[model samples]
Target: MALRANRVRLGIFFVLIMGIFITGIFWVAGGFSSPVTTSYACYFGWSVGGLNVGSTVEYNGVPVGSVSAIEIAPDGRLVKVVLNLEDDKFRVDDTIVASLFFTGITGLQDINLESLPDSVERLWSEDQLTFESDMPVVPVRSGTVQSVASGLNAVFQSMAQVDMKELNDQTIRALTRMNDLLDSVENDSVAVRLSRTIDNFDAVLVTYNDLGNELTAAIRDAREDAEPIVEDLKEFTGELDNLSEQLNMMGADLHNTFNVTNSILQEIRELLPNVNRLLDGFSGGYRGEEIWQ
Candidate 1:
């Protein structure tokens, strides 16, 4: 009875220990507790090489959940991942977004939730998004490989639209025109014509300088000659003024002489009548009254 009791107690102890161990294992495997969780789906058009189930999902670097499932959609065109967040109280409108991020040197990829600007706030659906939501799936971006491929595709597309042949022809024409200009500059006749033009310009300058000096000398000589001429003219004007005063005095003298001559002529006319009467009186006294009459 004592041995059986001891054996039963040991069995119970073993069973209890195993149960605790199993419960711990299930908890670590995300199966032990049923917490209120919200599930979200994100799809990557690029390959999800380093991503898998149970990978972590972080919101701005704070761990919120782990991946619940990873599968291709019905279209088989993208790798769709379902993330079950332990915390469901936070808001994740269009102001939030998800992307694929790598962790450590092993190249393991996870989903990263980040904030977006308010530009597209209204674009977010009023309803909260869930793994079962049937609306249009918002696009998610992947790092290195997708970006590099997209960049190359853009570059090739841009290159495809370029007109290489036309560009080459234009370059050749420009080179030809440049060569012709250089050749013309190097020609002997062009060089001779340039030198002659320079010589003509120099001669013209020398002629202008000589003509300026001659004009200056002529102006100085003309000024010197005009000074004596101006003085002579001044003296001649003074002499003419004196001669005019003398002519005025001579004209007054001639007027007085003409008045005296007219008085003498009047006196002679009166004396001649008186002398004729005197001669008649002498003849009357010498001969008689009849001879005097």
Candidate 2:
């Protein structure tokens, strides 16, 4: 009986050791954990497709955790996805918006947590999720679907804003007016009038051109005719200047002759006085002049 008890005791110890070994293996493989994890609920306003259990949860594209559970609301209007973030130190505030994003073409959905570019939302580290309150929820965003919808919405809005009937009426009126104008231009009398006006314009242009040419030719001819006159005038002026020089020389010679004549007369008068004394003895100065005459 003592031997049987020892065997049972050894078997129990071996079983306990194996159990511990298995638990350690599962722990290392992430089957269980002692670390605290954060949980948040994502209430998708839109459809959640391609998402299943164990979908990846990423913050700014970095893998941080995964979707832990999924359930529909009581009203069947929303799908709440519970996310388990492992060791996330940061608190999710209004600045962080959670959205559904694509991992690849595989159609696998991922939770994308990101900060809004406009920064309208505040970033708070102290904001904690209250257990009694409604789970802090982020609305899922359909990236491609939302973009396509927005673009289509804008296009539809613009198309709706246009008054198609009014636009068509204005266009028709404009076309009718243009047709009337075209019909008026197509009239035979109008065509003839237009042709006459064009001919008159052409004739005026030709006349102006001919007048310009004739004026240029006349000016050339006048310049040619004035050339000989200008040369003759230059020659006449030269001759006049020469004649003035000759007259000035003649006047100078006359002046010198007059001066010499005056001096000779004075000498003669003096001599006459002396001669009269002698002419009183030999026919006085006036008597000599009368004889000379």
Candidate 3:
């Protein structure tokens, strides 16, 4: 019984050791405290050559998640990559863009997420998905390689659409016309004519300047000649003012003479009336004397 008890106790100790070893492994492997992650899907129209499962997903260059799965879409026209991202690290919306980027020269590629400017309008609601998938779909943009390739393709297509032969003919005709115009100008002595015209214009300008100076001088001389006339006019006006004063004095003297003559005439008229009355009285006396005689 003692040996059996020892075995049981030893077995229990062994079981406890194994439990602790498992727990330590789980802790080291991050199984005990796994972060809460959300799944998001991205559909790429072009090739995803270097991207694979377990590839890093970066938000503005910071790793925030890892690719969980990669497969072809149901339509078989696109590659769908699923990302398991830590929750609350960043918000996912229509304005967020996912693009592939080469991590190194070894051709390893990763998905990078970036948000557009805040002023950009959100095209879809948060709950809306572009593809019929359980995970929310993040819009995928062309990678650098794909963008370069697309630009080259477009350039080639545009070149192919151009009428090169006609363009070349037009260009040749333009060059020929330009050369003919140069030859015509040279043969017609256009440069010499232009020089002669410029010289004539300069001569005319000089002549106009001389005429302006002469006109200014003539105006100054005329003004000087009129100065004596203006002074004579001032003297004539002063003489007229003196004559008017003399006329006013003569008028005052004539008015005084008229007043004196009227006063003398009035006295003489009064005396004449008295004399007539005296004569009448004297005549009446003479008549009485004659009657008496």
Candidate 4:
């Protein structure tokens, strides 16, 4: 009976140990003591490549939550992802945005939460309105990979629209025309004509230089010949100035002589009047003496 009791005790102990081990597993799996999480919806206009449920959600490179669900909106134009983030880990407002980025070189993608400046306006989409969840929507922006992929897509589309055959035909025609022009030039001896033209131009330049030198020499000789004539003209001007001074002195002497002659004529006229009076007195005395006799 003691052996049976010992066996039963051992079984109970084993059951308790198993129960504890299961509880530990459940706890580790987050079946118990689940953290308080806040739900948010993210809308991406681009392909969500490599993103799946349970993908890590990060805020500025720190893991803060996980992707709970991914689905296409009813409009079928945008992808909607549900993110479960730890409560109070960060704030979500109009300034908060979500983006998809590769986790590493593995090509696996995850959602990254980032803050925009307060001055940035919130972007809204028609697809976002279709979401029935009351969770605050976090607008999605293109990451580096998405932007690069978009650029490559545009390039491919542009290439697809190009008329390559026509372009090649035009290029061939241009090359043919160029070759024909070269052949014509070669056949016409254009190089020889060009060389002759250049030689003629050089000859003309040399002639022009010789003419210029002759003109310069003639000008110098004319200037030298004119120097003696300019000196003669200067001497003539000086002689004219001396003649003018001498003429002025002669005119002054003539004026003085005319004044002296006028004074002598006045004295002579006075003496003649006195002499006429003396003669009249003598004639009266001679007549009175004749009467006395």
lDDT of 2 by residue, 1-293 (tens): 99999999999999999999999999889788564678877765455788888998888888778898888754465567888877754466666667777778998888888767543332112242222325556533445654455555545555565555765665565556545554544344444544555565565566556555655655567766866555555655665565566556556555654654565455445444433433333221211112112
Q: Of the candidates shown, which would achieve the greatest lDDT relative to the real structure?
A: 3
- Per residue, candidate 4 scores C-alpha lDDT tens digits across 1-293 of 99999999999999999999999999889897777898988876666889999999999999899999999866687678999999867667766878788888988999998888865433333343655645678876667765565555555555555555765565565556546545544343544544554565565566556555655665567766866555555654665565565556545444544554455455555445544543443332111112112
Candidate 2: residue pairs that collide: 279-282, 279-283
Off by over 4 Å in 2: 1-36, 88-91, 117-134, 139-142, 150-170, 187-293
Better of 1 and 4 by lDDT: 4
Candidate 1 local lDDT, 1-293, one digit each (tens): 99999999999999999999999999898895677877776765566788889998888788888888888765565567787876564445656667778888898988887776755222113242324444334345435555555555545555555555764565565556546554544344444544655565565566556555655665567766766555555655655565565556545545644554455455556445544543443332111111112
Which ten residues in a row are the worst by lDDT in model 1? Answer: 284-293
Each model's RMSD to truth, in Å? 49.5, 45.4, 45.9, 46.4
Which 10 consecutive residues of model 4 have the lowest summed lDDT? Answer: 284-293
> Once superposed on the true structure, which residue ranges of model 4 sit more than 4 Å away at CA?
17-31, 118-134, 153-293
How well is each residue in 1-293 modelled by candidate 3, as lDDT tens digits? 99999999999999999999999999999997878899988877676898889999999998899999999877676678899999868667757978889999999899999887755322222243344676687866566786566555655555665556765665565556546545544343544544554565565566556555655655567766866555555655665565566556556555654654565565556455544543444332111112112
**TM-score winner among the candidates?**
3
Residue pairs clashing, model 3: none
Point out where model 3 deviates above 4 Å: 1-32, 104-106, 116-134, 186-192, 214-293
